[model samples]
Target: MRFIFLVLLALSIALGLGGWSAHWALDQSAEIGTVTIGPWVANPSAGAPDADPYSKARLAKIGNLTLGLGEGVQFTADRDAAGRPLRRECQYRLAGQTPAARVWTIAPYSQEGRLIQPGSGRVAWLTSNNLMRAEDNSFAIAVGPRARAGNWLATAGTGPLVLSLSLYDTPVSAASGVANVELPELTLESCPDA
Candidate 1:
């Protein structure tokens, strides 16, 4: 019995030491994974994988991420029948329900995951209840070069575009139900077509 107890105690101590070492490595800047969105993926040659999430030298910045599409969501920019890229447009659409605890937003960003900037990457596409609603309770934002009628998502000078929908204040457990939501196919539209 004593032999068994000692063995178990040694195993526990080894595990605890390993965990602490990992934590220290992360704090000291470890490497992490690259950011990928469908066919468009960013390979960061510099960032560390085990680095801290809050560190400035981390892999990539995340402007938008979807949480409510059943389990997870898939996004592609809306494309024309010819498979051509649509500008000031959403090629991919994620259909999911937002959690009650926090607010959700679908905003445009660049391949680097930074805010698209200047327009759709601006304050228009990214909205909350603080902004005025347009008739329907559902919020809509447009992405493009010039300002449109509804929410204006400014695309600075045109690069690959991506949309990130975030659900703040949501718990990890509640996010599991997202797999059950019957999401709609992402629609292709210019500024107002969708």
Candidate 2:
């Protein structure tokens, strides 16, 4: 009876610790090296040898090919500038001067990391080569489930979505030591029902 009790106690402790460790590993958001601007966050070391364990795990989970360090930086926004979670129920306007880069692209993706497909003639992404810029070089793109006049990114379903912006061969540095690089602005426009 004494041996059985000890074995049971040891098993309980092991199971408890295992559960806690899995929880932490799955939900850990404290990326070792990341740059945040407004709602967008970029991790420059995603594919590098020095990447953190969390980043490696996340990359494996997402199954995304990370760009090289000089090749580009990718930014993802799951929230709005007002600290509100980004939902497909609302429309948003993304406008601003992008950082210095050879090329860039922005796309709307569902929570599962798949591209959101809305309707015909409405693309899910905008590339730097195809954008219609103003005289001063600033650009605006509308993101919604419905069609808009200019530069619209279609969101197929309702619920939370993320906007991913990738800047290729950008002069902007993603290192933690660098400071004050300009990123695009995402503003909540309106919600018809909510």
Candidate 3:
């Protein structure tokens, strides 16, 4: 009787731990094959045919179609350069140059992966071609609920935000590996309540 009870307790504990681990792994955003630069993170193998089983499973759960190996690479930032969470109520500025890509796009999204809608007659996303650059070819974009002069990416509502930067037809997606390239810097300027 004593031996049977001990065996049953051990089995129950093992099953519980296994279930919890599986759930945690699936819910995590960053997994193996992920590269981090400042606040941005990218998984180069996310859309590859030879990706790991865990990565493939996570992508399937999200139902997001990642760029193919030759298509491009997508980087996401949920925080500013100082590692502070990006909030819609706070204003921010993205300044600098992107990697060597033929075309790129930047946009803000909610935590749930939905695009944050901007004010009427305002744009929600900014592409590389339509931006206004400085003399040195650098660009700056103001982000918040209020309007600003020069290039602006208007965001609405209140809550945490995520920024997506997609580089299309860039050599960073080559078969060799992800190159060490510099992405734009996101800095928090101010908040209305602060």
Runs with alpha carbons beyond 4 Å of true place in candidate 3: 1-20, 174-179
The TM-score, computed over Cα atoms with residue i paired to residue i, of candidate 2 is: 0.85
After superposition, candidate 2 runs with Cα above 4 Å error: 1-20, 176-179
Clashing pairs in 3: none
1-194: candidate 1 lDDT, tens digit per residue: 99999999999999999988766765565324323333222212222333335333332333333233233232233333334455543423333233343554556666555666573234635535553454544444445665566555566655466555444444422224433432223334544443
- Tens digits of per-residue lDDT for model 3, 1-194: 99999999999999999988887987773557888889988998788899888888877866778898888999999999999999998899999999888999999999877889887898989999999999999999998888999998999989999999999998896355664888889999998776
Model-by-model lDDT, in order? 0.45, 0.83, 0.88
TM-score of each: 0.44, 0.85, 0.85
**RMSD, each candidate, Å?**
13.5, 2.8, 3.7
| True-structure lDDT of candidate 1 | 0.45
lDDT for predicted candidate 2 compared with the true structure: 0.83
Candidate 2 residue-wise lDDT at 175: 64
Q: Which residue pairs show collisions in model 2?
A: none
Residue 143 of model 1 has an lDDT of 50
